[model samples]
Target: MYHYDNYDQTLVDERVAQFKGQTERFLAGELTEEQFRPLRLMNGLYIQRHAPMLRVAIPYGLLSSRQLRMLAQIARRYDQGYGHFTTRQNIQYNWPKLEEVPEILEQLATVEMHAIQTSGNCIRNTTSDHLAGVAQDELEDPRPYCEIIRQWSTLHPEFAFLPRKFKIAVSGAQKDRAATQVHDIGLQLVKGDDGETGFEVLVGGGLGRTPIIGVMIRPFLEKRHLLSYLEAILRVYNRYGRRDNKYKARIKILVKELGQDQFAERVEAEWAMIRDQLLLDQAEINRVQAFFQPHPYAELPAEDAILAAHKQCDAAFAAWFRHNSVAHKVPGYRVAFVSLKPLGIAPGDMTDRQMDAVADLAERYSFGEIRVTHTQNLVLADVRQSDLYELWQALTALDLATPNIGTASDIISCPGLDFCSLANATSIPIANGIQQIFDSLDYLYDLGDLRINISGCMNGCGHHTVGHIGILGVDKKGEEWYQITLGGSSANQASLGERLGPAIAKEDVIHAMEAIFQTYREQRLDDEAFLETVRRVGIEPFQERVYGDH
Candidate 1:
């Protein structure tokens, strides 16, 4: 993780002080609610349904043991004992009092963290692959690029206020685990034909009330022109993006209106005009990149007798290996997943003790490295095979090892109506009801890996657009009803699932899932996953089973 320089520290201190003054003015009746709204939003403070919520940015989801401890401290002293890890790789506290937020900001500033640009219609946090710097397939670490954009976009004079909020994601892995395609700007790091590192940029893709997969505007953007090209795209969006309606203000609508060819041409024209004039300095990129360089790692043997002995000795260790362990670059090392989603627990909720345990485990077993995945889970990046048994032992004590990493029961659920004011219904309980019915891990493994994503509202925070089994909550006649979508995914080939039928009542959700799974079991070919089966035979059979034919 990058430590803050004195200049960086000064900037954060100044911003915190500025926000404190703003809070005092608002409370003193000098600034009206309307006048103070944007200011508070810029500071990452939101007025939720019941109380004010504060979202603190965890840049690129990288947190040190000290930082994690501080966050846990903040949660315990200020709000509830738990914090929700969001899809954008940030954390939120739903019950912070308005007066306490400035103190929270000062606390966060002490640790080279803040809430700047976390909200409002400006560039938000720049997220990267959570498994950066250690992933085998990465061309370069993505965190430096994220930091580069963070510095540039933070209070950018021209783009401080735009038509809507903008988000950007970067992925260096061949597999798109970061959901790059659904972001406003998605950057895939690639090597040019000339062998220089560059970006394969995708533009205008977003998920809200409207969902569109971004178009590939820049197939191979050279390294030098990165910022210039981004500025050009933003310039075009700022000038031409819709302002008439909030729903239509996103850049996706503008891209759709222009069509792909015209949009590409306009971006190219815009880029060509200013590529050299506004290029970010080369020394700056290198300086930022140097901070994120991979640490020197010790070489070790491929085979570990300790890991083998553990697997041979225990049935539980074998089950965990089947789902949680992933191959790593080093011969003797591996990446192990610690499922935050224990059977009935909230998806990404972790207690203070749990956080401390994880921090200790990271330092003890993984060479002081921890990764918080975009899936709202945690990863032990370099857990030596020899330490697997001890790591599992410690994690088991914390309720972090459920042996379900990407199974039917390992659902991706948002806080929904429980925390989000925009949500139509409660999402957590809906997921709990469904999980209770599918509690059998043996049955889940028998059915194979399935993605069951649930969102409480149409905002798509849970990424319902790409789940293999997507459930979106909608209000029907003042009752909670879920609209299910089948065969969606966020991978190399991304596609939005189609609706099964009319929305089903909350009470009927688990039954609907049973019918849907049973349909897949009956219709799928040998060895096919849930997504393949649904794609092979569209959503008809599932729809028939769920809604009983027309």
Candidate 2:
């Protein structure tokens, strides 16, 4: 993790002080609601359906054990006893009082964390692969680049307020776990034909009211020009992106209105003007890269006999090992995913006690660091294979060891009508219902690699557009209805899901999903993944099963 220096600390301290004054003014009636909207938004405070929601940025999803403990303390003292981890790899406190938010910000500042750029029409959090440095097949660690972008975008005077909130994701791995294709700017680290590292830049990719996979704006962007090229893209969007309508203000919309070629041309022209001035020096690049160097790992064998024995002895342990643990770049280590989608709880909600315990676990087992994933899960990226059994037992006791990582039960969902004012229907309950339907571990394993993403509305906060099975909440004459989509993905083959059919009533959502699953089970070929089956046979078969007799 990149530690904050004097400059970083000073900037955050100043922002906290400024926001504290702004919040005090609002509470004292010196500032009206309309007047305080932008001020509060800039600080990552949102007036939700019930209370104020405070979104704290976990930059590139990295959190030290100390920072995690601070979050737990904030959850315990300020808001309710829990915080919701979001798709952006951030954390949200839903019940924080308006008057007490400044105190929360001040506390976060002490831990080198803040709520800046987590919301509003500005460059939001820059997210990356959860297993960045630890992934087995990565061209390079993307965190340094993500950190560079964060420093550049945070409160940049040129892009302080864009037409709409912008998101950026980077992936260095062969697998696109960061969902880079669906971001305003997606950077894929790749080796050029000349054997030099560069970025394959994609622009105008987003999921909201209108969902579109990004177009390749630059086939290969040299490492030196990364920031300058980004600046060029932002300049093009800021100058031409729509401001008359919020719904039409995303860079994706701009790219759609103007052809992809035209958009690329505009960015290129802008880049030609400023690329030389903004070129990155080698010293600066090395400074950022040094922070993310490989950890001091011990030389251990690839296989551990004790770990193998434990897996052979306990069925539950074996299940967890298979589902929750991923191969690490290091020989004797694994990246263990902490599943947040338990049976009854909201998908990403982690209690204060669990947070503290996880922090302790991270310190003891992995290095004293935890990672938040885009799938609303946590990652202990450097867990040794020899220590797997003890860690699994500890996580089990804390109710964090659910052996369903990519299964149907591991749902990705948003805080719908329950918390978000923009939501039309409740997403938490729908996610719960789906989890209940797929409660059987054996059934889940048999179903295989199914992603169920649920969003309350078209804002697509849940990333429903990219799920294998997407459930979208729709309002029908005050009655809650759910719409389903199939075959969407954000991986190497990124594509938006297609709508299944007419919306199903809330009561029948579970049944509708069951029908779709049954259809897959019956129609799929030998060991075919849900996504492959969907693409092979199309959604027509599943749609017919859901709406055939209706």
Candidate 3:
């Protein structure tokens, strides 16, 4: 994890003092609600349906065990006994008092964390693969660049208060776990012919009311020019991106209206003027890279007999090993994913006890490091293979070992109408409903590698547009309804899902989803994945199966 320097601490401390004053003024009736709106938003505080929701940024989803403990303490102290981990790799406290938020920010600053840029139309958190350095198939570690971007964009005066919120993702792996293709700027770190690294820059990709995959603006941007190129792109968007309507304010719309060619040309023209001024030198890059150098690892055998014996002895342990663990770059290590999607509990909700338990596990087994994933899960990125059984036992005791990381049961869902004022229906309940319907671990494992995502509204907070099965909440004639889509993905070959059919009544959503799955079971070839079957047979079969009775 990147430690905060003196300058970083000073900036966060000053911001906390500023917000404390602002909050006191608002409570004392010195600042009107309208006047306090932007200020509160800039601080990542939202007036939710029930109470003030505070979003705390977890930069690049990396957290030290100390930070995790701090979050647990915050959850127990300021708000409820739990917090919700979000798809953007951030965390939300839905019941914090508006006045106590400054204290919360102050607590976060102690651990080198903050809520800045988590909301309010500024450059949001720069996210990367949860297993960035540890993944077996990565081209290079991308977090150094992600940190650079975080430093450059944090409180950038020129880009603050843009027409709409902006998101950026960087992928170091060929598998694209970061969902780079669906961000405002998607950066793929790749090597050039000279054996030096650069980025494949894609711009204009986003999801919401209107979803579009990013277009490749430059085939390869040299490492030195990454920040300069990004500056140019933002400059062009700030100049010409939509401001008249919030719905049309995203860079995707700008790219759409101007056409990719015109957009590229304009960015190039802007780059010519300011590229030299903003270039990041090699020394700066090396400075950031040093913060993430590999930890001291011990020599161990590639395979452990005890691990193999444990897998043979316990079926539950075997299931967890198969579903939740991935290969690590090191010979004796495995990256273990902790699933938050257990049945009946809200997906991504973590109790203070659970948070503290995870922190303990990270400290004991993963070099005191933890990572948050885009799927609202956590990662023990450098766990030794020999300690798998012990860690699994600890996690299972905490109700965190669901073993459904990529299964249908591992759902990505947003806090919908229950907490969010923008939501049309309750997302957590719908997610629970689906989980209940698919309760059998055997069944979920059989239905391998399926992604199910639900969003409360069209804002696509859950990234529903890219799920293998996507559900969006809708309002119809004073009742809650749901619209389903199929074939969407956020992987290397990303694509938007097509709507399955007309929106279904909320109560019948589970049945409709079951019908679609049944159709797939009957039509798919042997060993065919859900997405493969969808692409091979198209959405027509599922659509007919879901809506034909109506």
Candidate 3's TM-score: 0.99
Query: Where does candidate 2 clash, by residue pair?
Result: none
> What is each predicted model's overall lDDT from 0 to 1?
0.85, 0.94, 0.93
Once superposed on the true structure, which residue ranges of model 3 sit more than 4 Å away at CA? none
| Candidate 1 lDDT by residue in tens digits, 1-550 | 6789897899899999999999999999999999999999999999877889898888888887777777888888888787877778888888888988999999999878899989998989888887787778878778888888887787798998889999999998888878889888999999988898889999888886898888898799876787888888898889899888889999889999998788888888999999989777779888998887655656878988878888988989888887988887778788899888886788888887788778888888876666777778888888778888888888888899989888887888898888788999888997777777666777878788898889999988888888898899998877898999998887779889898888888988888898888999999889899999999899999988888832
lDDT of 2: 0.94
Q: Give me the candidate number with maximum lDDT.
A: 2
- Model 1 lDDT vs. the true structure? 0.85
What are the models' TM-scores? 0.97, 0.99, 0.99
Model 3: worst 10 consecutive residues (lDDT sum): 437-446
lDDT of 2 by residue, 1-550 (tens): 8999999999999999999999889889999999999999999999999999999999999999999999999999998899999999999999999899999999999999999989889999999999999988998999999999999999999898899999999999999999989999999999999999999999889997999999998889999999999999999999999999999999999999998999999999999999999987778889999988888888999999999999999999999999999999999999999999999999999999999999999999988999999999999999999999999999999999999999999999999999999999999999998888865788889999999999999998998989999989999999999899999999999988999988899999998888988999999999999999999999999988889846
lDDT tens per residue, model 3, 396-504: 9999999989989889999999999999888999899889876677777788889999999999898899999999999987799999999999998899999988899
**Model 1 TM-score on a 0 to 1 scale:** 0.97
Pairs in steric clash, model 1:
none
From the highest lDDT down, the ranking of the candidates is 2, 3, 1
Q: What is the lDDT of residue 450 in candidate 1?
A: 92
Error of 2 at 312 (Å): 0.5
